[model samples]
Target: MLFLTRRRKVQREGIDYEQIDKEWDWDHFLILQAFVGATVFFLFPSLLHGLPLWDLRGLMVAMVVHVGVSEPLFYWAHRLFHKGYLFEHYHSLHHSSKVLQCFTAGFATPLEHLGMCGVMAAPILGATLMGFGSLGLVYGYILFFDFMRCMGHCNVEVFSSRLFESLPFLRYIVYTPSYHSLHHMEQDSNFCLFMPLFDALWGTLNNKSWQLQKDVSSGKNDQVPDFVFLAHVVDVSFSAHSPFLFRSYSSMPYTFKLILLPLWPCIFIVMLVMWAWSKTFLVSFYKIRGLLHQTWVVPRYGFQYFLPFAKDGINDQIELAILRADKMGIKVLSLAALNKNEALNGGGTLFVNKHPNLKVRVVHGNTLTAAVILNEIPANVKEVFMTGATSKLGRAIALYLCRKKIRVMMLTLSTERFLKIQREAAPEHQEYLVQVTKYQAAQNCKTWIVGKWLTPREQRWAPPGTHFHQFVVPPILSFRRDCTYGRLAAMRLPKDVQGLSVCEYTLDRGVVHACHAGGVVHSLEGWTHHEVGAIDVDRIDVVWRAALKNGLKPV
Candidate 1:
């Protein structure tokens, strides 16, 4: 719920999400300890004795205690915390985080947390004193309290004003995220815990709370992104690492999780449902130098790409996403992962050809990709072995290296394709391009560029000390431990990237796939041409220089 709400933030003001990510440790521990202590105290008979497991009377009593005692106490205590000494020494710690995430509810100084713990205990103690306490009531009240705190601090408006309009008294009974957000921003109003009735009675409610809630819930503040990266899932398990599912997990490079293994069947079922009913949806968003950039998922998996029958369906999804971006006046839409597969859509050529008048630039982003891979090869090296030699990236690498007077042993069974690429090179350098059918033909070459996956037996052909550079998806297995393998071509994003809390695939923080960065450069340069179809080999150096000028460090 928190993740869904955050995607539709009520307050669009900029906040350092990275800073907030770093500030969660101590407060999280403190809150966990408090909850555990409360549970232990209520369960074992330390102060208030453990009662029956379930009782209707205990449930009713818990509500009364909360409304009559807990709510008022918290309201007054919250207001007090905003005043002179309390505000400066303790409460200000919580208020320091101007942006409210769900965890923000528990992010407070120990003293403020202590007071909150006390307020929570009031309801359980009161129920016990009234001879109606039960184990169910204690657990129920505590869980409900925690839920309300998280909801208020979640920073997104989930409640509709229509609910309040239908039940007018509910406004005084329950406070919304917008209402709590105003208290954080304004600092002197809307000082309620879970109910606005206390604030109403004390004449401290913010005047804009209701209107702001209505406006946000109705989506009046949503902004159109300037650039969108059209991406797809890599596999079933890794799909759980999406930013909307788990912030901490998505913030780091992904690895197979043993814990997630048990959930594979469930996740696979979700994939089926998505294949059946899902449309393209926003996965994450961030800003770079005031430009709104978003990542949208195509709702298909990597394995699906290899299934010939699923090809058209996948392209249909990508086409829909492109048209949608164009309709929204988006400037650029870059295809990522299999969304730009050459065999699938000819590296986004189908859409460009079908809709030639598209105002939105459809970019395959392989230009920078070719540049990154090409630059990774040592400039002094004279000869290199290339696999998947006839593919888009392979052809470009071969031609570029041939022009540099470097020998490129192109591995392919097709003589026709090799000759076509060979002819594209300058006549003076055409001799540098050599065609080889067997992997053993390049056994003497130390520089191996792999575009296709190599099996253990096939990998044995590479002599010792050979370095394998790759642009392959699900990068080839490191079968030969003696050789060093390069990761998929990638680059680090600029230092000023904002609200980027999720990592791109297996890349580290602040780093993205080279193609992803390519799209970013295209948008930043305001290039009006569509970077679709075949990669312009001539523009490889241009994109590389532009990336460097824009602060994109090669990784």
Candidate 2:
């Protein structure tokens, strides 16, 4: 069945189908190891004991023990391997293969393999300890474990929606191929090997597991609907310094190396071609389907064209994103990070003026960003140290916080702009502690609202215990022991959002900044005008509710 399905190239849920070729060798080696190890273990252990054949009753007990005892042991052991340096050193080897096949089922380091083997054998081991062990039951259990492992890793959806729809309760207990595939995608979820009892009880189930299962089981294949596209460019020139890029490059075969080694020069040539073409090339990046929504997203720049040094091309990239959105009948096109800066004169006013005929509404998403940031701030946070205080986002946050009677230590590079804002403050804010400074003068303040991109040096210099409300992309703070950081994101979307799936620009908690969330909100609301600069604070509720309706927190 597996071979027949593979030959037909049947649809695989949540897999990069192309990655199968890349992972083939590693997965093949592990399959060989598992068979060899199982053979040796089976032969050697039985040679000492001779055969203790099972009756029907003994076989039934062993089966129950495997599910009741062996599964829980494996679950905890699997979760233990996920902890800190253990995952980095040992278990991460298995995760290196993002695309799973039956061959990839047992692809773990020797240590992990041994741990899993020990866990899986606990049922037979217990039966022996209790003096009723049978060789037939032992062999049966071993086959069962290997079969289930292979089934979980197979790029096939075996469980149909009718089974789940008719017996909805089974959805909680059953761990299908799609369920385990979700674990491969989201490393922190769906930890149980045979059943999802532990995962559901412990709250480690992947958010998308049920949905992916339902979508695939219901016969929803890879075809994308006519949907709005969205994403930011990963300027390969700038990402050349990224460790992730270097690691990925080094792991590739020599043939891949030959191609990727000259990526920069190739990108330059591609950019010139694109420039000559003088039209946006809409490249379908990826497609996603949820129970309620399906979308096809595209990014708007060649690697070389979006490099920071290539400032002349930034506006063209912006025009391409909007134009492509319009071309695709995208209701709303949200500008991300640098794209937002280059468009609308950093406030969205310029884009509205330059492209009045555009059907797609352009949004900066500042209002929802301010709202999400402020929502995460604790009520006891009476003081906040803010950077980028002169920018539109910074001023809006300052005004909002000051209205709440919070002392704000505003920091900007310019003292002139600082004093001007203070002078222009509301009459009641005249007596408030809205101090202005040109340096990192605020200390002992636990709350920080960083609205500007900071250098690595400045990021390191930020005070300890400062809970940062970070708005900058490629976040400034490291995962520090002393600091707590809240990345700006859209969270807990409302159900009314028809099948929205935000791949990037979100924290695990589902929080997105108002900027991107604002675009999603506009798309949901059918609003097609420019929502630039400072968004009114009152609009936060509208954005928040939109996110909730799309599935953030249930109504």
Model 1 Cα displacement at 253 (Å)? 1.5
Q: How well is each residue in 1-555 modelled by candidate 1, as lDDT tens digits? A: 222543357766444446547554634645565676768677865545557898898778778888898889998888888889989998887888767778778877877777887888887877777888888877788788888988998777888778987899999998998889999899999988889998889999888988888887777766778899988999999999976566677877898889888889999999999999877766667888899888888899999999999998998889988888898789999999788888999999999999989999999899999999999999899999999999988999899999999999999999999999999998999999999999999888899999988888988988999999998888999888899999999999899888777788888888899989999999999999999877889999999999999889999
Candidate RMSDs in Å, in order, are 2.7, 16.0
Candidate 2 deviation (Cα RMSD): 16.0
Clashes (N, CA, C under 3 Å) per candidate: 0, 28
Highest lDDT, which number?
Answer: 1
**Model 1 stretches with alpha carbons more than 4 Å out:** 1-7, 13-17, 26-54, 165-168
* Candidate 1 clashes between residue pairs 3 or more apart in a chain or in different chains: none
Best by TM-score: 1
TM-score of each: 0.92, 0.50
The CA lDDT of each predicted structure is: 0.85, 0.61
